[model samples]
Target chain A: MRISQLSAASGVPIPTIKYYLREGLLQPGEQTAATRAEYGEAHLRRLRLIRALLEVGRVPVTAIRQIIAAVEDETMPVHEMLGTAHYALATPVEAAADDDRHREALALVDALIGELGWQVTPEAPTRAELAQVLVRLDRLGRPASVEKLRPYAEHVARFAREREMDSVSGPREAAVESLVVGTVLYGKVLDVLRRIAHESESARRHTSGHPAAPAG
Target chain B: MRISQLSAASGVPIPTIKYYLREGLLQPGEQTAATRAEYGEAHLRRLRLIRALLEVGRVPVTAIRQIIAAVEDETMPVHEMLGTAHYALATPVEAAADDDRHREALALVDALIGELGWQVTPEAPTRAELAQVLVRLDRLGRPASVEKLRPYAEHVARFAREREMDSVSGPREAAVESLVVGTVLYGKVLDVLRRIAHESESARRHTSGHPAAPAG
Candidate 1:
């Protein structure tokens, strides 16, 4: 396929496609003439992944570049590739400005990790992100103690082990796509549904609240 | 206490705290003199929440004002207040660019809501959000059909009914705090934990293959 067809089929504009090529997000196509380069299914697949990350996940361009580098690095171990992809999804939370609250939050997070018996690295950004949330919750006087969050922790573990991992063993591109889309977007799927559930439960409590009435 | 003390207590800067007040996210303090005003504990609490939403949740100032307005409307029913809060957490997804893909995605979202037995409104923004995520996933050739997403939908429902609704029974201010923080910040918590779980799973698949080995 030519660049024009790729844009038509993928619904991405031609100039934006050129921009992606310049950004090294999409690989260059086979050179056929002075002004034209031929693309294929591979280009289309890559374009789609890039859009999903940028549009739905809202991942930063720099992080996406790193992730794409990993995807193109076919020789890289799948597990290792996933490590970088997961790490790149979140930008680092600013360190607690020497705030004592951070110390306690960090301790609380580490203890929770210990209780859960999960083998995670000490410096994983996600661990720090969790600690930051607890601190924020506490400052609001609506502190979510680890015990309060324990149930969620357990559910996440099971979801990751059973469902999220199911895709890890597929072909590299497919597997990477699963990790990128699943980690960021599906996390969203859960968030949006949780809101719906909030609505349903609120309706149950506030109104006569029959069972899940289908939307008319 | 004065605004300066509120700033100290909440760790938000004086200027930013005033911005919240001007934006109507914070209620005005009692005027003590031509140039001085006194704040109370409530001011402190509101400041913390504003910081949490802005710094951590990254909710826009406009949405924060709307949410704060809802929060301040003490006469507002809890269910109604929550409805607005959840809706405010996300801006509307662009109306599918008139792409035909949107129709199928919306149908799928409605079907999934039906299958899960969630009583959500037809016009709920979260419903539109779920549809958008699915559409993005499909474009990546990683269509997460209803079945694939069913488990998450069920998990979310259970989490909402049992855990999230627990907070709705609190005081109005506290309840609104939970809705805003829980919907936005805790959503990040889940996203982070899911990443951690991915790390552990990848470690399990790649390395020593131990259960969650504790961080050093």
Candidate 2:
């Protein structure tokens, strides 16, 4: 297939496809002639994955490049490849050096991890993210208790298990691609689902004459 | 206090505070003279909220304007105010005017809502969001089932209930502000927590020499 066909099939514009090729996000097609190149099924699949990450997952182009590099590296362990993808997808959370709030947030995260018996490492990007949220919540004078977050964590673990189950079936690279796409895109899915559920619960409580929960 | 003092108090830079004022995300301080204005505690609080929404929640300036408008509207019901905030926070999902995938996704959303006995309206922005995710999942050949999503929804409902509990404690306007802030920022919190949980679960399943779950 020519670049035009790849664009048509993938529903991406030709210029965008050319851009991805230049960015090395898409592998270069076989040069059939001076101005002609041929794409293949793999290119189609890769293009779709890139679109999913960029549009649905909102992953930055630079991060997507890193994720794609991991995906294409056959020697990278599946687990490590996954770690690379996850790290790329995470928004870096910055904290002030030597800030007490940062210290408190880190301690709270450590305590939560211990309480849950979760096996994550101390340096995971999510640790900083969790700390950032905790610090901000504390600043707002509504710090969250572990008791409040435990059930949510348990539920997330279950969802992760389900996602893992969903991603482990295909061939190695394909499976990794699926896992990367699912992890980033499905996070958006979960966010939307939760919002919908919140709307439903709010409607039931406020609009349907089911007496609103008493104000605290 | 002058705008500079408000900036000092909120830890938002003077230029960014001025930007927020220009954007109408923050109300003007009272004009005391030709070039001097006196800001009060309310200005300080509003500046903090603006920063939280922008920096922590990652809400766009335009959406923040709509959210702030809803927050300041005294006549808007509390539930309605919350609806405005949620709508603003949602990533708009555009579907073709006559697309089968769109229809199928809508059907799936309707079926899921009926199955769950949820009270959400058909027109909720989240309805479109849910449909969009379903459509994308289907395109990726990993269509999510109601069975898979139900547990996640249940967990989301629990989180929503907890959020409601937290928001009902303060004065009306303050409660509304708290609800808005919590809804946006806590979504980030939940995302980080879920990522952490996924990392932990991945480690336990793959890195600890435990037998991995069988691929589906």
Candidate 3:
């Protein structure tokens, strides 16, 4: 396929495809002649993944570049690749200026991890991100006690485990790409799903004086 | 109290608070004199809420104004207030150009909502957001069947119900503000927590050659 066909098939514009090619997001197609090149199925797949990350996942192009680099580098351990992808997707939270609140949040996160017996590294980017949320909650004078968040954490753990298992069942490269893409986009999916669920529950609670239907 | 005190209490910079005031996200303080105004507890709380939405929630000022307006409109039903907040927080997804794929994704979302008996409105922004994710998944050639996402939706429903219950225990205005703030921040919190859990699961799976201990 030529660039135009790739754009037509992928629903991306020709100039944007050229931009991606210039940015090295899409590898240069095979040089069939002086002014033309041929793209194969791999190029199409890569373009689709890039579009998903940029448009649906809302990942920045720089981050997408790092994620793609990790996926293509076979020497990088899959675990490390996954870490790269996770970091790329996570929006960096600014650290709280107050040391006391920051330390308190960190300690709370540490205790929660200890209680759950989850083997997360102390340096994981998410630890800081979670701590930042706790700090923000505290500053708002509506701190979320670990006890209050524990059940939700348990549910999150289950979801994460399911995601991990799901990532292991496909071809290695494709699985890695899917894992990264899925992690980013699934967060958005969950957000929308949760909102819909909230609407349902709100209707049930506000319209009637009874609890909602029993959980499945 | 005054603007500086509000800034100090809210931990928002004076310039940012002034910006919010100018943007109509914050109501003007009581006029004490031609050049000075006296801010009260309401101003302080509103300032704090604005800072939370802007700094932590990352909501645009235009959206924050609408959310603030919703919170202040006591005659607005709680359900409508919640809807406004959800709409303000949801990142809109652009529909795919392929009508067939878009329709298929919409049908899948409709079926999922019907199957779950969820009381989501046809115009709910999240319905479109969820459909967009499904479309992106299909474009990637790895469509997420509603059956595959059912258990996740069940869990999301439970979480949403918990959130709704949590929102109802405070003063009406404060509760509405908190709901909006919490919705945005909690989504970030959940993302980080899920990433941490994934790290834990990945560590256990790859390092020990066995699945992690049974999910609690």
Candidate 4:
């Protein structure tokens, strides 16, 4: 297929496709002419996968390149692909860029896993993602202590599991959507709810005549 | 109070204080001399708030600066601050970065609150955090619709709440910890759990007496 045909099949705009090609994210197709190129089913498949990683996984191109390289490498195992995807999905991008704090964050992540006795997978929260937080801390000169994060991790892990239980209804499309929205949006929602929850608690206390004196 | 004194009181280092001063994240203390900068209780207080925004809120310095400025401005309405923080916490950083998408994400979040008939503040994932996925997708384009994300959000959110209900005997410290953990780490954890869930489902289907093709 030609470039336009690939564009039609993949639903990526021609300009975007050209951009990907320029970035070396997508491999060049068969050289049909000095000015034109031909693509194949492989390109189509690659494009779809790319879209999934970007749109759903929200992975960055640099990592995507590495992941695809791993996928294309015959020496690499299928488990490796799954592992990479898992890592790509879970790991943060910052961890990869900053080597100094990456190990520490990983240690924290591991410690949390151990401390909580969580049945978590190998690729939970991409290293880059976690590292990004650490890097920010380093930049802020307030790098979080691993010990400080342990409890945080444990609490979140428990809820992570709980949320999974709530949303995993036969792996339907809607099920995946719930998972994304909950994890992506739940914290803010809870924060809002907690505010109201606090208000309600206060109202109850006031109405019940347990009116605590305001802080002096 | 000197830099060291403020550092000791706030548990922030002198270097970090300097950085905050240089970044204008924290106001400069009274300048005693070329070498000596006298700090005060206000500096300590500012440092604490900065830490809260950076660590707990995971807000960027730029945003933090704006927020702090707004707070200091006084003319800035409380609702605006609430809206900023509300959106900061609830919406994905990248989505919120784009004025249009940010509004849409916020609208959807509001819709969720209304639809669920719950009083909850929706938090957005950080753009730096979400950027990992976007970068990945740029390389590995896949065809995904916004429709698929709904269940993903719901499941994670429900599980988060359920976990909070389970873990917190007192919804104070433990609740706060759970909130952070669930928000930051649950997605990664769920990425792993989903795999296990998929495998378990596969096994169950295969082992059952009823013969059916594998669904994935």
Task: Give me the TM-scores for chain A across all models, comma-separated.
Answer: 0.85, 0.80, 0.82, 0.48
Q: By DockQ, rank the candidates, best first.
A: 1, 3, 2, 4
Which candidate number has the best TM-score?
1
How much DockQ does model 4 earn?
0.11
Q: Kindly list the per-residue Cα lDDT of model 2 for residues B1-216, writing each as its tens digit.
A: 988777777778999888888888888889999999999988876766666666556778888888778878878777777776667667777755648888888888777777877776667878877887787777766788778777767767776776544554354446555655666667777788878877777666556566443322
lDDT per residue for candidate 4 within B18-49, as digits (tens), equals 89989988888888899888887667657766
The regions of model 4 sitting more than 4 angstroms off are A1-3, A13-43, A54-78, A88-108, A115-216, B1-4, B11-43, B54-110, B120-216
Off by over 4 Å in 1: A1-76, A209-216, B1-76, B208-216
Q: Which predicted model would earn the best lDDT?
A: 1
What tens-digit string does per-residue lDDT give for candidate 3 at A23-55?
988989999999999998888778866876776
TM-score, model 1, chain B versus true chain B: 0.83
Q: How far off is residue A151 in model 4, in Å?
A: 7.9
Model 2 regions lying over 4 Å from their true place:
A1-76, A94-100, A145-148, A162-165, A208-216, B1-77, B92-107, B138-148, B162-169, B208-216
Candidate 4 lDDT over A38-89, as tens digits, reads: 8987787667667656766677999778777776676754334444554555
Q: B-chain TM-score, every candidate?
A: 0.83, 0.79, 0.84, 0.47
- Which residue pairs show backbone clashes in model 3? none
Q: What DockQ class does candidate 1 belong to?
A: acceptable
The residue pairs found clashing in candidate 1 are A118-B212, A119-B212, A119-B213
